[model samples]
Target: MGNEKETPEERRERMRQRELSNPSSSGHGSNLSDLVGGLGWKGTGLLILLIITGFVVYSLATGN
Candidate 1:
């Protein structure tokens, strides 16, 4: 029977099982905050770049 139809409960159960199987890639966007701690190195680089850019702009504007 290739044209099988699943009931509502069956569909829900299937979705739950799929989520439990792959918890990391479950199409959830709520874990993006977890990336903040993981970006330690990148965050430091970004801060350095911002500071350098600000200094350059200030020096150029003030002729220092």
Candidate 2:
């Protein structure tokens, strides 16, 4: 069975079933560190960029 090839839909359904059977394994209840770690370097960089942009916009709006 391990050697058998699964179609994309089949694989997706299998994964869905696995997640349903093990809710904790889906990472929905993970901590902040785990969530950030899962985002990888590029995602972390983009998040930092967004935060800096928001700060700049707020500062400009407040004229401070």
Candidate 3:
């Protein structure tokens, strides 16, 4: 029944409350947003892209 439309700020507050209320949340430190500056899964993809591009550029520059 708590499916009412919540603004982004409200949604974040609700989630923050839930995490604070749950003791087990402590073990999982630094959720995805905090770890990636709020980039979440997109950050993972971007990081992979950067690594691959770097390797390609390095090989081409060194003629290897």
Candidate 4:
């Protein structure tokens, strides 16, 4: 009994209290990891494209 896990409702309430205490970090936009988690394969491709574009731009700018 002492080592029992918290119920879902209790966990949610705890999260709500935490968010109420620290508003910024708990907001929807602040949940960057969760937001990015749903990007899946498309997000990965976009990230790769951006990285490649940045590298190309940097190389051209530096004449390297």
Using lDDT, give the best candidate's number.
2
Q: Please report, in order, the local distance difference test score of every candidate based on alpha carbons.
A: 0.77, 0.87, 0.83, 0.79
Residue range 1-64, candidate 2, lDDT tens digits: 8526888889889999998799899657877777679999999889889999999999999999
Best of the two (1, 3) by lDDT: 3
Q: Which of candidates 1 and 4 reaches a greater TM-score?
A: 4
User: Once superposed on the true structure, which residue ranges of model 1 sit more than 4 Å away at CA?
Assistant: 1-39
Clash pairs, candidate 1, are: none
Question: Clashes in model 4: which pairs?
Answer: none
User: lDDT, candidate 4, residue 32?
Assistant: 51
- Ten-residue stretch with the least lDDT total in model 4: 26-35
Task: Write model 4 residue lDDT over 1-64, tens digit each, in one string.
Answer: 4226888888789888998888787545556566468778799689779989999999999999
Candidate 3, residues 1-64, lDDT tens digits: the string is 5657778899899888998899586797677667677776788789879989999999999999
lDDT of the structure predicted as candidate 3: 0.83
**Per-residue lDDT of 1-64 in model 1, one digit per residue for the tens?**
4226878888889878988788767667556455656669788678679889999999999999
How big is the positional error of residue 46 in model 4, measured in Å on the Cα after superposition?
1.4
Model 4 TM-score, 2 decimals: 0.42
Number of the top candidate by TM-score? 2
How big is the positional error of residue 57 in model 2, measured in Å on the Cα after superposition? Answer: 0.5
